[model samples]
Target: MKVAVSVLGLAAIAAAHGYHEEDQTPIEGPHNALWYNTLPGDGGTQADSVFSGISTFGRIQYHPCLTSRSVKYDIAFIGAPFDTGTSYRPGARFGPSGIRQGSRRLNLYLPLCSRRVGFSGGYNVPLKANPFNSWAKVIDCGDIPVTSYDNGYALQQIEDGHNLLLSRAPYTDADKPGPAKKDRTLPRLITLGGDHTITLPLLRSINREYGPVSVIHFDSHLDTWKPKVFGGSPSQQASINHGTYFFHAAQEGLLANDSNIHAGIRTTLSGPSDYENDGYCGFQIVEAREIDKIGTDGIIKKIRERVGTEKPVYLSIDIDTLDPAFAPATGTPETGGWTTRELRTIIRGLEGINLIAADIVEVAPAYDTNAELTTMAAADTLYEVMTLMVKKGPLSGMKEKEERLELKA
Candidate 1:
């Protein structure tokens, strides 16, 4: 009788605590169930919570763009998880996952005063837009299945994987017109890369879709090094490293002649002839020191003049483009590079250019601080890139703050 009374008392306490053993009760009213239990695009899979659900770039919806032919996206965040091409650091193979993890706080629906506020997808005040909330259908397509044993095979995998995603027709939207290359309205890929070498394969893949596209290469090193100068001869694998991939790309006729530009270059070269060789590969250099002499707007103007606003441009950013103080976790750590703000400002200035595809590469999270500074910087830089894309093309019809302020004036 005492045990039975104890059990009844426990049941009463459980009830008081709002515990239900046989509870299959449907959630009622305007509660968190709408945010937690529903799928993405409905209420979202609670990925917006930042602490919950699968980690994707910006907590965006995930789609198997590589495996499924039916899945279409206007902007797909694909990962190239191959870092065997790195000469100085090896941990960048984990860059794709690290970048995604760092991007968790992005695209969040804020919870305030124990109540969900008006739906806002992590707005960018400077750009006056939220890319996640934009009309473009953006999704994280996950990482490429790249091999680690052989660099040659791994590069091919990256090429094929990028091509697979790039070839897919974009999700149809009226306000978001897909960038056109050869009469086909194709999707854009914002790639999270393993290392700088991945850009070569990506360029090869993009060349198929858009032909010889102009390149906006951002790094502390000129990647257009000759095979023999960087590493080669005995092993061909040694030739096509992160330092020399752009050389291969140029040789393959994948780059637009005289239209490609490399900004933030500060690496110690073999000689002045290296710059000549870089010119032969069709890339104009904007040295890192130029930032001090000319400033961000000047650098932006130079890039705009070089690549032009008309042609399809591939934007490739190595994390080392930022100073080691800002982004220390990279294959190559160059001290005197642009700050994240300067880089973002330059990227934002390229608002009117035709950007077909882009990648943020060489983010080795293993070398990052406990705060994940490098990883966060990389993700935020990509966010800026995404904003640029969101504002361009058909979406450019929207008026900017400058335009609105001018009207008031």
Candidate 2:
């Protein structure tokens, strides 16, 4: 009797809302009109509020570039959610999602005054341009599926995912004239890393296309430590870690000699010999305190002179490069690092350099504060990178390399 009374009560509640078992569909009412959804759909418009949609990097449109051959994109944001290579901390696997969540306000609605002036896309006042409004077809490719149990498999997955995007033809619109002249142009990838170790596989994938590109590594530690000094293991796979991945990269010929550089380094090395070994691994150091003596422009000049403008360059940014006060949620936080604003200015100063690919890693959001400072810094730095790519357009070396191969044939 009690169960029957409960069923009757549910039926009464449903009847109050005008429900019928046979209808099976919503009844059209004034409140149920489609016109209520004045916000923009996923068709790439700024009508929706920043808080009201699926989270993507800067609320950009998402496409599965790995599985779809028809999908065209010039610059794709991919997430590498593996952090097994971390030595000190282990929560960087969550870095990718954390960075995305912090990027909610990046491309929000335009300002009232700017809208009156006939501006449409989201704008960065410092950059003086809107990357989303640029000609490069940009999309978020989601995250790479990596297994956490085995480091080797996870690293291989990163390399494969990066290579797949690199193999796709760049999206081009005939109405909008871009920097690429070739019919078959490769796309640039902006990777959200799981850890600093992820750079090894990324560089390996980049080597297949650009052939040992110069690396502009921004970190607080000299990641080029030899395996013996970093750590040793019986298993060869276990030996390749975040602190020693650059040594492996050098061994595999994935780095261009005399062109790579490390900026903002201030870690206490094992000894002075570590610096000598670092030089042997092909990286010139720019200490963290050099900013006081030379300033940002001076450091930028040094990096520009090191990598130059002709060869392909890969940028690897470890979030620990920023001081802990600015970004505390990293696997390896070092004191006396650069500020977020200073890093943005330095990245913007690198405009017109041949940046083929880039990654920002080591953002372990578990250690972050309530303000989400670390993730916000990583996202805004990524914004600067995207803006830099838009300002420079596509790499011209893609056409030149293909022509060289054709000549050999």
Candidate 3:
């Protein structure tokens, strides 16, 4: 009886621990398979997550504490998850979190590529710059802690949050030469947006620093249509919708007129009023189809020439700028857009420019599939912009006029 009982117990144990069908190998032991770092918190009330068995991007060695204030930050990776202003779709409020989830695993290898990518072949061949793999002082400052329910209040909160980050001192001065590393040292903001509307608050923050910087906008839509054009009361002229914020921006003298340019635009307009608004804002339009004609090099040349080597630039990317085939998870995704590779290459060509601040927005993850394609694209775009911030000036031929025109905050 005892022998029979022991035989049954072994069978039950083996049944509980399944085996691989291919080779009939048992799964690894519990300790071997266990992951996640867990520790006791202060006073032993809760447990702190210091180190897990597996890789954790949030707790990566170089990442600073979210509450850290004394240490000067070169860039604060902030999330503004507000999608209140979307015209057609509305899942963008989850963009920041989706992006974070997609980029949870970080290393030198390209997530989509077969080999490691960094500072290698230029646009024609293309390469992904893995800045996070370096000693970049990047910290996930968490989200903007935005409140839902009210549109006006949300914008106010978002603006206030950015203002506080902007107000922090002891940040790197990337423009200073000699002792400090010019581009690496200067303080900057890289926002993982709630939606395109977040740019208005960001621009408002940057305008306080650069006093109306030029804009390098990458989007499938012009986004300069008037509030009424989008259908609203004239009294709602001051209203701040994602589609109409740029119009308000132009109205408020927040953008450097004639220095702003839009790339990848394919959205249909309401006629002459659209041109009038764009003209009023002094924006040069580079239609999406023009990419085939200009190629990446020509596009870079145009952007360089449009914004020039000098003057502060605010780079804004609405993920819908890429073809829905590559990024279908956006709210108002326009078809016939640039491919992920094309978009990444184009952004790479924009290296070594005088970039002051930047943002990547409109990543509505609800429509995204389990694969997380759109969120990953937004994350990749953020990495490219971070590299651009890293690869700033004293260009090959750093002209004196160019130096003078380069505004420092």
Q: How does model 3 fare in lDDT? A: 0.67
Query: Model 3: residues >4 Å from true position, as ranges?
Result: 1-68, 108-130, 133-136, 170-186, 234-238, 393-409
The residue-by-residue lDDT of candidate 1 on 3-39, one tens digit each, is 4465556556656755454431221223445554211
In model 3, state the lDDT of residue 115.
12
Clashing pairs in 1: none
> What TM-score quantifies how close candidate 3 is to the native fold?
0.74
Question: Which of the two candidates, 2 or 3, achieves a greater lDDT against the reference?
Answer: 2
Clashing pairs in 3: 37-51, 37-52, 82-194, 172-186, 172-187, 173-186, 174-182, 174-186
Write out the backbone clash pairs for model 2.
none
Count residue pairs with overlapping backbones in model 1.
0
lDDT of 3 by residue, 86-131 (tens): 8788988888878876654433211111111111111122333435
C-alpha RMSD of candidate 1: 9.6
Better of 1 and 3 by TM-score: 1
